[model samples]
Target: MMKVLLPVDGSEPSKNAILKGIEEGLLEGKEIHIITVVPGIVPVEGYILSPHVDDTNQQLAEETLTDAKALLADYPNVVAVTRKGDPGTEILHYASEIGADLIIMGHRGLGTFSKIFLGSVSSRVLNHSECSVYIVKS
Candidate 1:
């Protein structure tokens, strides 16, 4: 069975990718791994530390993965996870670590401004991914 990695961020487009994957039977009998990556903010040495930074990020990541899991409820052999780091790099790393054959993700994540500010995650993943990458535009 093929291993498909679905990296999402609770966006409408990401939801569409999951629905499309299921409707297209791309997930049938395949191991589907749903992932959400939260980019963690690095603090400078002199900055005042917020004790809740990690907790907030962890919560957001969990919430994002939970929503993705709900969207993927109909798909069997599905596992969901969340990570904290650069989304593109994290997704690529996860794909390699899991030996995934395919990477499916939304073309846009969270907001357009973020994509504009930090180059598109999909574009970055496409450039660096070792395996086949499928970008679903919402």
Candidate 2:
């Protein structure tokens, strides 16, 4: 069975990616790992003074993952994962860690500056991933 990584961010484009993957039979007899990256309240190496910020980030991550789980529950092969870090790097790392054959994700995430900074998570994955990458747009 093939393994496909579907990274979502609770965005319409990400939802489109999930739907597209299912419609294309990309998940047929395969493992579908759904990921949501929560950029931490502070960078990994940075100091965070506000516990409130940390709590908020955690809550948001849980809510986002819960929604993602509900959306993907109909697919027998799907699994949900939530992490904190750089979205593109973490997504790509998880795909490699899982030995995924394909990485399917949205064209862009929740950030606006991503387009100018790195284009998108999809772009970064396409450039850095060793596996095949499929980016869906809404």
Alpha-carbon lDDT, every model: 0.82, 0.79
Error of 1 at 121 (Å): 1.1
- Best-fitting candidate, measured by lDDT? 1
Alpha-carbon shift of residue 4 in model 2 (angstroms): 0.7
| Global lDDT of model 2 | 0.79
Worst 10 residues of 1 by lDDT: 110-119
Off by over 4 Å in 1: 44-49, 114-119
Best by TM-score: 1
Q: How close to the true structure is residue 44 of candidate 1, measured as C-alpha lDDT? A: 88
Task: Report the Cα lDDT for residue 127, model 1.
Answer: 90
Clashes of each: 0, 0
TM-scores, one per candidate: 0.85, 0.84
